[model samples]
Target: MMTRLKIGACLTLDTLPDHRDWIFEADRDLELQDFLSHAALTTDRDVLIERARQALDGFRGKLSIHGPFEGLDIDNKDPELRPVITARFLSALEVADRIGARKMVVHSPYTLWYQNNLHSYPGYAETKLARIHDVLGPVLRRAEELGITLVIENIQDVRPETRRAMVDSFGSDAMALSIDTGHAQLARRMSGAPPVEDFVRDAGAQLAHVHLQDVDGHADRHWAPGEGEIEWSAVFRAIAECEAPPHLVLELRDATHIPAGFAYLRDRGLAV
Candidate 1:
């Protein structure tokens, strides 16, 4: 049974071995989520990427990787701090490149705090973009060189246009947008951010990747799709309208529930 739109799952090495057959059964796309951690990126990175690359030898679908984001900011104000951030992202991109990933998902730098206090300083938005470029500039070049696109996933971004500008500032084909439905919904629920649907609509063709987890609109639930409050129909409708299309990944916390999530969307004719 072919999916209405191609969909995939975010998998860790632990789950990868068990699900490799399922992953190939229908040629589903894959997002390597484990490399987004410190343990997988440092000290043990070679062993990790080698194992994942070996296991995915026959995968026919597109590939992506989830880059590290914890405690790192792409737009760090300190010029001294920007290099460290850049190093971290470049390391993650190395993993993505080695694994032959088409895209790498990086966390957006925008925050609810930054958006709320836009008036606190002059040229806040412009400075933010400049800082981001200072850090991500080299990483972007490296990504383009490796034939990999960098997709910025929304975290505390209440203002989607700001994310748009950050992506636009690079003006490189390697830069694009990603939406984590759960995070967008949590921002809307907690701080009046735009709904998840709006994020999808705004990204339009430039939307290259998506983390398709369902949330309660209260927190980062990462639940199976049908269990959450998000309007799946509207979300998929907007996704269907995308001009560039995207890799839809079921990013559930429990890999066991991924089949359930895929079924939920498939039953509704949203995916396979």
Candidate 2:
């Protein structure tokens, strides 16, 4: 039977092994902030594209690109820095296009620092959200034009509602949620937020992508699904109940865990 969801593993330079049958989530390695700082595009761009093609060769499966998210911030308060950020994002979208990627994963602009200082500035959240919308608008339009779905993953988002509200405000079909199970578990332990299953349920229809890793509830361990204390059964069930199923990627810390993670999901009848 063909599952409604697609399953894959996160492929870095080191893990581009014999994954010919599974889908892939390719990570962009070029640090765009550095490129933007140096104003050098030709050599680096050529190398990035060549390496991406080599890494993706012989893979007959769907592809998604993990957009550059190291030092770039879409919600940066600095006016001058916003353009640089947007330009770097545009570069990432270009890479996605070259690779024929169907979707891209971007980290949410919200952070735990904002939540901690929520009371300091009464309208800070609104201001940050507005800036994020403005910064991401062009990138989202480009993704839509390229037939790509830009999935926003939660990093420091303690409350899924805040992220959901931000995504809903755009009202664009090109943008959607990419839930990271390990991050959610860590947030629940560190900030008293909801658990992993609750996040999946809350995301519901908005969920379009997922990092199906597990954690010990204290830190982002990024272990295989069944190796940690997370309730895999409950999480998968919540996902199954969603109106739109999401692409499930085994974002394990170690590549060796990939086979075990797939087996664990298969045993539970949640291969996708």
Candidate 3:
């Protein structure tokens, strides 16, 4: 049996717009119950486990998961908010455990605005990171107990130095790098840092997961592979050269685009 690369989508159950737009829309519609209703109707733990089994039934591939993206803040500074985030993280891990997913992706929860606006705050990044470590430490310990891998992704304009700092602070192999292709593209465009491939190669030893998507040199629209402007072939080559290739998860915004993405990888002789 030929080995296939694990292809998974982010936990984007609803079609909400970008974060900024969502905040503005929410402010306008105070009575909007659509968000809660949508969440209530989507797959629960049991349902997700079954779905995972069904999705991977015949495919000779590894399994991974992208945890819920919305309304989760692992780096919240508020003491009252920490438990809620921790609970959600554990719940996500439960789903991963049920589905036999080896890796789960998580974000630091601080947006570009939060970082930029708080530049004057004392120990800004350190405080947030330490809070994150405190919140994630137990969750990761539990994941380790359950034999699950948690991969942290870099988002917004967070510098590579900060990324490395966050990862090192976590202090575990379970907490490794999850390179988001679109985010890397955005970083390169804005900062003129090394290309995405270079970042992946430099973090090769610590890479544990990847979020595959395309961006049109501006925003991360999560376009299907080859639809936007990412060099998919070069990415595959980089992964192939890694000491241990990270699990590649297709973080497309839409499920309908998954098949085409898989086909593109297949055409490149990369398992999917």
Which number leads on lDDT? 1
Candidate 3: segments with Cα more than 4 A from true spot:
1-43, 50-60, 110-120, 191-193, 263-272
Residue pairs with clashing backbones, model 1: 3-272
> Per-prediction count of colliding residue pairs?
1, 0, 0
Write down the RMSD of all candidates, one decimal each.
1.8, 4.3, 9.4
Please write out the lDDT profile of model 1 over residues 1-272, one tens digit for every residue.
22378788999878987677778888888998888767778888999988988888888889999888887888888888889889988999998888888899999988889888899999988888888889899999999899999999998899788798789889999999999999988988988988888999988878999999988887798999999999888888888888867988999999999889989998899987
Q: What is model 3's C-alpha RMSD?
A: 9.4
- Residue ranges of candidate 2 with Cα displaced over 4 Å: 1-6, 21-42, 54-60
| Quality of model 1 by C-alpha lDDT | 0.88
Candidate of highest TM-score:
1
The Cα error of candidate 1 at residue 130, in Å, is 1.4
State how far residue 116 of model 1 sits from its true place (Å): 1.7
User: Where does candidate 1 stray beyond 4 Å?
Assistant: 1-3
TM of each candidate vs. truth: 0.96, 0.86, 0.75
Candidate 1 weakest lDDT stretch, 10 residues = 1-10
User: Model 2 misses residue 25 by how many Å?
Assistant: 16
Estimate, for each residue in 16-81, the C-alpha lDDT of model 3 and write its tens digit.
Answer: 222223223222110111212224224445654564456444433455666655666777778888
Which is better, 1 or 2, measured by lDDT? 1
lDDT of 2 at 77: 83
